[model samples]
Target: MKTVLVTGANGFIGRNLVATLSRREDVEVMRIDSKNSLEELAEYALKADFIYHLAGVNRPENTEEFITGNLGYTQYLINILSSNQKKTPILLSSSIQAEQDNPYGSSKRAAEEAVFAYGHNVGVNTFVYRLPNVFGKWSKPNYNSVIATWCHNISREIPIQVNNPDAEVTLVYIDDVIETFIGSMDDPDASYISDYHDISRSFKVKLKDIEACLVSFKSSRHTLVISDLKNDFERFLYSTYLSYLPENDFGYDLEMKHDNRGWLAEFIKTEHSGQVFISRTKPGITRGNHWHHTKVEKFLVIEGEAVVKFRQIEGEETLEYPVNGLSLRVIDIPPGYTHSITNIGTTDVITLFWANELFNPEKPDTYYLEV
Candidate 1:
């Protein structure tokens, strides 16, 4: 079996990579972190078929620690591997800050040079990824990534500070980074050295846009409105935001309106696409004997038995469709067609309803009629 060694195995990227590698049966993984000694890392280097040099410190208390942790430790790893005459391919996770003139940037740049020189001397493969801001579930908050800090704070209803809302950031999701790292291992030529590799799909978004989207997600609970999920950046940001919510806060109760017949609750509503609501009808009770001018709807019975009756506004013939929990069917209510659903079973019937437009209190498009 191929042996893989990962440095900084407990850090954000390291933990995620190790978790992924552990699930594969073809390779054995050696995780190295602050808990492990240099001797232990050296021992693993001798046996490792591949090395992922991901250990680095971006948020150290002392400025000198950046050099010791990022540059010194990387040089130490290269020395150990070179001493043992091991020419295994090493993948290093560098950052976009390496191009800047700060201390942390200089250390990262020095580490990249050291890894490149080692590959040239030993004729081994080396890959340096100058990754952008990465955000996901397991990232540490208030340390390195602003995205993590914002998501964590907003999830708990804490206030966030934004210095420049107009500033744009290029972000790469952690899953995509991991996928690219894994794909490099499957390459046939492992001895080819590279200066830097860019993640293929990075999103450039303004700070204000991100905050607005996240705020909308928070307001969705009360407003029952959903963001435009069709946008890729919005979709990814929404997923990441939800990942930061406290476990107990996962489920929220929708406001259910009660009537003599039963109850109805709006699940989600969108600006352009419309809304979804659910209702319960008691046995022998009927609901919705109405026709719409421009609003179209769909009805789905998920429990008990329901008979959906529809009649054309201009015709006398009425069509009925029987639906039940066992064999659920969606009945579409076309515009200009009067429709009604009756609970024909012994138990209360549960029906899910979808409409083409959000319900406007001022201008309701519904017209009462008998079907």
Candidate 2:
């Protein structure tokens, strides 16, 4: 089991790290933030496998806020971790602009330098990941991201103004960034430099186009940079960037066919064996060479052609059957029955879905065999 600590426990990224990491069974975590109001640092930070230092201001109104809230908090974390005397990995989440010309960027750079210096002598595996703009579902409004504000405008039908549409910037999904940071923990090859470019005005996106992606808006000017946005809405622009793919798996049942033309019809999933369970299979692919102790399943071929082979542990086995018929197909496997399917057609293969019960990770009822 792993015990990790996340500093800056109240902020957007901090909350996200907590929620996401909590899903894993083997991980135990500690969160530090202003809400808890803990005065003792070393006691709060001891005996953790990793320390993700994300406690700091996103975009401070003045240099003083940056110093006291951002750098100061990080420096305090260094003292606590050093005093703890444990060889835990410390991941410093810094912004790309930290060392750049921006005020927030400069303060971040200072903290990054301190982290490196601390790691050199403190016996901690210190590493830094300077992330670009991170956007996704559950993103807080207070975070510094223009993309979230845009999304808010989309949801609220608020009028949007534009300034610099041609500035170039990079944007990545918040989930992806989290995966990157999580993957970096305890990396024996921990290095010093990690750079990220997020969706800021650096990338040229027309003002109307940004609004068009989510909603319709009236704007005379097209696009603008972080500096051009109104100060009254200073924090609004820092919302996470939006992407085409929704965070969850769901959409309309429309064919919504596009350029793929003849291929995607095969990849769609439309079959079910239980009340509700769905998965996709491709042409020339085979699945489920195993048997369930209590799982009885049926597959309905919705597209392409498929052939299934079934063998009962204490009974006779059955030969393959043609599954190319677009009509519903049913093949129920009794307990201790083994089966698998293969696509026999040239096009993509798809099946309508269903399952008797939800799959349980802790108590899987299935067993696999190579043959």
Q: Tell me the whole-model lDDT of each prediction, alpha carbons only.
A: 0.91, 0.62
Q: Candidate 1: minimum summed lDDT over ten consecutive residues — where?
A: 186-195
Residues 10-60 of candidate 1 have per-residue lDDT tens digits of 998988889888999998999899999999989998889999999998889
Candidate 2 lDDT, 185-215, residue by residue in tens: 7456765433332322223344454554444
Q: After superposing candidate 2, which stretches have Cα over 4 Å from the reference?
A: 38-41, 59-62, 186-208, 216-371
In lDDT terms, how accurate is model 2? 0.62
- Say which candidate scores most in lDDT: 1
